[model samples]
Target: MAAYGYFLSCEEFSPSQLLEQARMAEQAGFEALAISDHFHPWNDEQGQSAFVWSMIGALSQVTSLPVTTLVTCPTVRLHPAINAQAAATSAVLTDGRFRFGIGTGEALNEHILGDAWPEASQRMDMLEEAVQVIRELLTGEQVTHHGPHYTVQNARIYTLPEQPVPIYVSGFGPQAAALAGRIGDGFVTMTPDADLIGRFRSAGGGGKPVIGGLKVCWDTDRDRAVKTVHRLWPNEQLPGELAQVLPTPRHFEQAAELVTEEMVRKATTCGDDPDEHITAVRAYTDAGFDEVYVNQIGADQRQFFDFYRTRVLPDLPRSR
Candidate 1:
């Protein structure tokens, strides 16, 4: 069945705040939870980036809902071997409820290492290699790998769960989606793009689940919510390859200046009415997503949960 989930922007809330939100989300009937894994908030104004791993540990204890990273980059800030170990432990802690969702990454987060950011093609290569390394390590066998981007010697995860954690890969374009289909157990993308989903399945994803998410805001004042989203997440509206190539948050902020609040409002659903949120989610459902997750942007956490549970969830058609 298609699953309904919520995406938590970890950088936007304190750990305690997130713990509360998770509990509320569970009680409100969300089937799963996906959290953003970023070393830094896209901009400092967004305010928080509590280490995601630590937050995940706390989340496992606070709620019964399954938690996964919306997408984490295993090739850069953290090595695949270490990531594998972390995922294994998290899976055990969550009682096999963890899914490792990963992607090629953004310059805003990965470029902090002072390493020259490779081109997309190279990054994909690194991702493929990283996935192999991670999978091998999860086997609970000694692994020694010498790859173009990574090397691990005699590594074996001692804290692995009874089952290997499923890896869901996020992609935007056709090539990346195809890569996810070929290598990932499931496919993840933010866009509600049916063509991309078809390409992924055609490229060998088979019957694996497809997950997509969109941002929304639940507020009595729609205009204010749109303005707030654009002010804080203007980077969402920047088009083209610039997002991939921008080297710094300042660059992002500069480019983001060109995106108007209207653009954000047009792209996202923001309003007091839960129907608006349901319509936004329906776009993803109609686009052929196996699962659609909604992310409530800005604060107003309690109101957002209540809006979804009382007004939106009841109206959504059950996934077939």
Candidate 2:
């Protein structure tokens, strides 16, 4: 059994649209919310990237559902200490319902500061150190550290929630899973791979929650929906480390040109089939994920919510 949530894509929608979707998600019976933290859209047609911390503040005023960044990178572009403060403030604003989801991050966002992009292994080391720094700062005690990747001098977060913010670490492979298991309060990934979940548990994540998500297109016309996904999110089909290494939206667009509509159709659930959507989500639950988030790829969000409210959610297995 798992709790189902809606994923708010900052890469695809405006801040106002995201706030409205948060409201709609709660109203339509979603149990929680997952929002992407991106400095830029994957492609131009996606067209929007709001500062996620500011959007979180607005979300606090709009919805009562718990929110998690799915996820943010604390290792580059911004120091982990700065992110700790932002997460602390977000936790307070959400009344202790914010889950801090973090990762090693992608070059597309991290490279903007013109810092040399580290290799995968080095980035992993930096992520471990960044997580350590963030956790220490979240305790609200003054912290002074001279680590391999970061430096903090008597730094402390003045504002924090009554409970410490739970940090969910994201990973897509065995090494990263082991790191997440050893250090994370919870684990985040986009796929529902039971073997990966087992790897996490074996590495010491046994009692911690596992979170995953997927995207779908809901529309009256299946072909049109496929085209919408092809145009707006062909980047999703770009395989391997390309997503983590690509430096900019233009580069992503260039890479996405290799993706085809047939590929998008094969990978995503498109059109108005409730059973298809239900089955897509069930994959996560079946793979032992504690929570699963679903993102509607195109602009039919209100309709998607309504359809899920009436046709999908009631049929899914509940956590209880």
Candidate 3:
């Protein structure tokens, strides 16, 4: 059975807009929520990046739906212990409704401190160690660690939820999928790829939840929607490790010039067609994802919610 959720993209929307979307998502029958964590926007036009922890605190007061960080990077930009503290407090505020989703992260956000970015292999090692540090601290015990990537001397997180927060690990490759399976409470990935999910299950993620998400545009004019996506999310089509290595929004913008509108049209579902939106969601449900989150890429979110609430959402089976 797959549960549908809404993705609140912090990279694109302001804090106030995200809050409104959270409220609307619940009103539209979304079962849960997932928010992205980024210190910088993918590009300037996407134009906003609020502190995820602060936004999570505010979200608790406004929405009863469970919230998860679509993925935060605890290995860099911030220490795992500090992230653990934030996650602990968020879990408390949400009354045990918080799930901490994390990943190895990209250089675009993690390199801002001028720390030499580690290659993917080393980053994965750091992430695995970070996950251990976060898990230990969430137990409300004093933690003293001297690891290769991080260290904590007598650190403790006092506030926590009644139940331990579930840590979902994000992956886009086979190695990452295996690591997530071996170490994560759950798995997170963007696509509805059954092969990737199969690898995770074989590596020990069988009974654990697998979460996924995508972005779409909803407008009466399909060409306008395509143009909106091309303008705001051209980076989505950048191939290979370009997304992982690009150092800044400017680099992203420059690289994104290679992404074409037709590419976006083929890759994204646009316009106000409920059937198109329904098919996009079914791709994930038909795969083995336990939950799927969807994001409306540009403005016109109110209409997107109304369309889903009245047509698309209700028509899709809640459980697959």
lDDT tens per residue, model 1, 24-77: 999898889999888777776677888878988999999999998888899988
lDDT of 3 at 62: 100
The model with the greater TM-score, 1 or 2, is: 2
Per-residue lDDT value at 53 in model 2: 96
- State the lDDT of candidate 3 residue by residue for 123-232, as single tens digits: 99999999999999999999999999999999988887889899999999999999999999999999899999999999999899999899999999999999999999
Per-residue lDDT of 1-320 in model 2, one digit per residue for the tens?
89999999999999989999999999999999999999999999999999999999999999999999999999998999999999999999999999999998999999998999999999999999998999899999999999999999999899989999999999999998998999999999998899999999999999899998999999999999999999999999999999999999999999998999999999999999999999999999999999999999888999999999999999999996
**Ten-residue stretch with the least lDDT total in model 1:** 38-47
Q: How much lDDT does candidate 2 score?
A: 0.94
Clashing residue pairs found in predicted model 1: none
The TM-scores of all predictions, comma-separated, are 0.97, 0.99, 0.99
Which 10-residue window of candidate 2 scores lowest in summed lDDT? 104-113
Displacement of residue 223 (Cα, Å) in model 3 is 0.3
Q: Relative to the unseen true structure, what is the Cα RMSD of model 1?
A: 1.2
Query: What does candidate 3 score on TM?
Result: 0.99
lDDT of 3 at 319: 63
